[model samples]
Target: MAALFLTLLLLSSAAQSAERTLVFAAASMKDAVEAMARAYRERTGNPVVVSVASSGALARQIEAGAPADLFIAANPDWMDYLEDRKLIDVESRTNIAGNTLVVVTGDGAIAPPVDPEPLLRSGRFAMGDPAHVPAGVYTAQALDQLGLWEDLRPMAAFGENVRVAMALAARGDVAFAIVYGSDAELSEDVAVAYIFPPETHAPIVYPAALTANAHEDARDFYAFLRAQAADGALGPYGFTKPAAGSGS
Candidate 1:
């Protein structure tokens, strides 16, 4: 009886300690989400597990059945990809934030009207894979909008994610990278060369949603972010509040 009681107590302790919410967020939101996780734990004692990566990669992971509690994508398209497959709770989905694109260099600010073609000819320009990564998708669209796509294609160095692309510039492997305004602040080595006009491509938006099988606590964490954003929790990290009618 004593041995059985001890075993039961251990199991109970394990179960209590195992309660955590898993969130898959876009790479660009890493700093903000990490900050939120710390605050959430202090307030509710419910730990949050945040996985950061490119929206495309995170969506693919979800499609392949990774056990994600929440999905906060850097763009709506990836969240749409999951929602179409019934992987997400559509009613819970909302645009949580917004960002803009920028071109930056590690060594110094490159003057704008930012003619990228000649710059690309002499140096490899970094971006997330324009085919899949949201930042890259936006970059490509903007380049096309500016008539720079066809000419600059050959000089592209694609990273699997936005941060990876920025790292190329951060590490001096590439001098320039087109990245989110939020993410550029992460690398001391890179400086903003040009801010892409919002009209250059589709507006950058971040949408968050619960998985269809999300933990009940997942909803709580989601709500906390919304509340805190209103209270300025997101401001320090360069996140902008979602505009009205843009909440998805």
Candidate 2:
């Protein structure tokens, strides 16, 4: 009877150890992070929960006292906002990767304009709402650099987020939409019209942090995300590791 009781206690402890939850991530990271979370759970025997939305919205939610074990943002600005509010563990904050912005059109759509300027002057374009989505800010900057912001502004259809912008382009509602290279890669239904030159806008860095309210298991998962072995996990999702000393 003593041996049986000890075995039951071990099993119970294992079950308890397998439970964990996380929240706060950008909308664009939903697909990749969800897959990563599933893999992490299987490997570590711990479950993970995620909340996805625009980084700006997530930041507002956290500032309003939402419970989040972790936060991953598409831009540094929002992460800095959280740090300033003392909502995240400063030591756990780091820029994990970067991504490119691209202009994409529906597959087999009319060939893209050689110069985006002509397209902007003639037809509708789609982009995320810059006030709320990181991708939109990047797109705005790119257009500004090209001297096309004012001209393109009139034809722009602003989606709630990058995903919505991509959907608009895929549906042929707009000639093209600005979205992350990774997002364009996810759907063969969309064909990339052009890659916004790196010099055209600020680099899009994805920074992650452990929320101050996180449990030990959540912190462990956060650490796992920063491990070198996790590079492969990030690559397929259109992320490239940031240079050492770059995130600071």
Candidate 3:
């Protein structure tokens, strides 16, 4: 009888030790982060949960005391916001990857000029809400740089996020949509119109950090994400390594 009791206690302890849950990332990281989480679980035997949404929205949630263990934002701005508020562990914060902004058109549509100027003159464009989606903010920066923001403003359809912007373009509801290069690759219904010149806007940096509410196992998972082993895992999903001396 004592042996049975001891076995049960040991089993319970093991179960507790193995159990792990974390809000693993941002909406833009849906594809890559999901794959990484699955691989992480299989290799480490720890479960990770992901929350996908606009980086700004996720930041607001974390600030509101959401139980997030880790945050992977599509841009450094939101991560900076969290750090400013002391909601993230400073040592654990790092810019892990970069992405490009691309313009997309629905199936059968004529590709717009590689430069955004012609597209603004041609027809309406779809983009995420600049107030919340980093992709949209980047798009705005690019447009402003091209001196077409005023002209394009009249024809803009704002999506809640990049996915929605892609959807709008995919369904032929808009002439063009600005989104991440990864998003363009995922949707066969949409064709790439143009890739914004990297010089036109600020570099897009995806930063990850350990949240203050993270468990020990969650922190371990976050560290694993930055390891060299994870580099290739992030690339196929349209991420590039951070430039030298770029991340904070």
Candidate achieving the largest lDDT = 1
| RMSD, candidate 3, Å | 1.9
TM-scores of the candidates are 0.90, 0.89, 0.92
In the range 15-87, model 3's lDDT, one tens digit per residue, is 8887676764667788887787888899988888887889999999999988888998888899999999999
Off by over 4 Å in 3: 1-8, 108-114, 228-230
Q: Which residues of candidate 1, in runs, are more than 4 Å off?
A: 1-18, 110-122
Per-residue CA lDDT of model 2 for 130-219, tens digit only, reads: 997899999999999999998788889988778889999899898888999888878878988788888898888888998888888888
**Which one wins on TM-score?**
3
TM-score of 2: 0.89
Residue-wise lDDT of candidate 1 within 76-118, one digit each (tens)? 8999999999999999988888888988788876676556556
The better-scoring model by TM-score among 2 and 3 is: 3
| Alpha carbon lDDT of each predicted model | 0.86, 0.83, 0.83
Q: Where does candidate 3 have its weakest 10-residue lDDT segment?
A: 107-116
- lDDT measured at residue 212 in model 1 versus the true structure, 0 to 100: 91
Name the lDDT value of residue 247 in candidate 3.
69
Instruction: Count clashing residue pairs in model 2.
Output: 0
Candidate 1, lDDT over the whole model: 0.86
